[model samples]
Target chain A: MLTGHRTWIYNNQPVIISTGTVGGPFEANGNIPDAFDILHDDMWLKQSSFEKAQRTMMEEAAQIAIKNSLIQKEQVKFFISGDLINQITPSNFAAKTLDIPYFGLFSACATSMESLALSAFIINGDGADYILSGTASHNAATEKQFRYPTEYGGQKPPTAQWTVTGAGCALVAKNGEGPRVTSATIGKVVDMGITDAFNMGAAMAPAAVDTIETHLRERNVDPTYYDLIITGDLGHIGREVSMDLLQKKNIDIPEEMYRDCGLTIYREGQPVLSGASGTASSAVGTYGHFLKLIKEQQVNRILVVATGSLHSPLSVQQNDSIPCIAHAVSIESGSDNQ
Target chain B: MIFFWAFVVGGTICVIGQILFDVFKLNPGVTLTIFVIAGAILDGLGLYDPLIDFAGAGASVPITNFGNQLVHGAMQEAEQHGIIGVVTGIFEVTSAGISAAIIFGVIGAIIFKPKG
Candidate 1:
């Protein structure tokens, strides 16, 4: 049901039965290697192009999710997925391989939570029993499409973020024994007139803050409601900026209770500059790391706010400012049915 | 000695580009555009010819040389055929490089796929 403005209260509480996460060599060497179900040493995954490799990762993630669940591939009714590639071709191709009824979404990097929210909404209303919600991103493919050729020797700015080469998928079902999807807050497009293509962290900070503030307001809860309020791919600068903004707004989210998926995925000195940014940053971080913590009863609840910068290469060339958005989903430890 | 100077001159030019990128915070595309324009201006002022004589391939091999060639060809043609030659000859000397790049680009697309 629609709770306050822009917020959906999942009264039926759809559960995430299982998750599948796949990472590339860079992620396998990162801070949360244990979280990934499969790690590929080769970025190509023996594929000819980076785009095809990305599609393979998405396929693997979806297959793994289904395999881990109690249901078979035929029982999985729908696949809702997206990616950062041009026209989201990686996701479309992955959907073709999965051969399920598909809905390809695009909210830039916020695709993960956006898909999850939609899946929960559908399941809450008895639209489908089993839905796959996930996203994938390839570093080389994203860099090639958004900036330059992979071989081009371009020095990125300090505020620039590294795109994760990975995928994360969760199997959401009407009845399951896993984390419960309680509520979701959809964010509006927020542009702060930042024109630098290299400084995405600064460009995306306001959108993250807006969604976070609105989520708290609409839910009628304080910052301490969730064990952690995790922002998707905000990285170092955006995280800090959003924290300051929250403080100024009197939201009073304690520093320790707030975390960023971008900062959590890679350790210090990984040459990730401002840290990770991509659809996979939040998807992998949430499914691979935080969900494990929930399963172990280490953290009870988490509010994942995935932020996305919705600007194309053409928009940047045309000197148009970046429009950003965020989507927040609250996941508790277990379902009432469980 | 000639090779040594060429290396030094070329390295110096690259270092200047690095400074523009790091210190001035110009992106690669903008930095490269500035270099090309600077080369044309220097050649127009009769300064780049002497540097080319001193540095050989170092001065000629850098992307700045493309701008120098454009100005050089345009001026020579302007002297012989009046105003319209300036427009006609601007691309004459740089045509080989552009054509080669197109041909090689197509071949590369056909033969090679992008690696991760």
Candidate 2:
């Protein structure tokens, strides 16, 4: 709903652009550029070419995470990822080229955090030292799989997510100096199946922020305990409603202290009307922008919860609303060293 | 005979695009861009012109049809000029459409007291 806090994060980077909408407008635009890498789950691989899309999105996600992580090609040690597709093409491709001994896992949107949680566990369990986890989703791909085509021109309300057309990547290591995955309290899928896809973002946004609140409670940290925390791609309306709800729970979150991935994902007035959603919205912002902030000592502790709306065609046909789930992954940059 | 289906199908596609605008509340430009790109891809794969030839203006007036026009115009230019065909590109291929949008946008801006 607002664009004020972004300046503090990027020193006022000119990344997000807004389109002028008429009054009575309550939606955020989610458009990014062509050259800007997207988290599209399918990468527009067409109906029969889904496998290729999966590979492209996953590899694209991994390459991005690796680049932002600044880890050598072989230093990744392990790859973790997941998706809604058969055999997890995104995760497969994320692991294929780097040859870091891939470990694929899927809990949908929560996979971002799930991967982080597992990576932290491995670091804690004496498995691999450095782990990279990510997830990617495409509007075209997800629309084809879950809804209609870009050609369908179906009505989408503000509540629905704009299925982020990109991937999100994260790198977790056993540094122990930065805010570690201190502890995580995961939430179950609370989808009551409100199948209207347009409003799905609104539905999912609450679950995500709530999980964040819970994660903070479990860690025994206050809302301001960490400098900044970011939520996955909840569009304009969802972001506003989530903050309102958080404040109701007495979580004093300054607008600057928290950010939404969708709000930061695009350059507006292009094509994508929402900010950014898919796996990429958070992936790029977190790994690219979020990690950069963490390293700069701008903020020490951060909590991130990648959210997913677990709506299936089967559930929609049953007159159900799209169900949403959120997974929390707590991360902190340890003293800017590790 | 084929024109009948062209009129029905192409008109339906246009109506869908419009409804997407009116009911779905999507902007016309974005809707146009998506369909036009889709039309270009379909034409590159060789599956759109016959319908256009059939529907005539029905397929030609809307933004999706404009995209088809661009693709076909490009293909025609490509054959005649070989590699240099796309050099002129938007000006040669989509001059009228681009001019129309610019002209209309300016006119809309001028005619309506715009406020951001």
* DockQ of candidate 1 compared with the true complex: 0.44
Pairs of residues clashing in candidate 1: none
Task: Find the candidate with the highest lDDT and give its number.
Answer: 1
Candidates, DockQ? 0.44, 0.02
Give the Å error, residue B3, model 1.
Answer: 11
Docking class of 2: incorrect
Q: Kindly report the root-mean-square deviation of model 1 from the true structure over all alpha carbons.
A: 2.9
Instruction: State the TM-score, rounded to 2 decimals, of chain A in model 2.
Output: 0.76
User: lDDT of model 2 at residue A288?
Assistant: 54
The ten-residue window of minimal lDDT in model 2 chain A covers: A16-25
TM-score of chain A of each: 0.99, 0.76
Show model 1 residue runs off by greater than 4 Å.
A335-338, B1-27, B52-61, B77-115
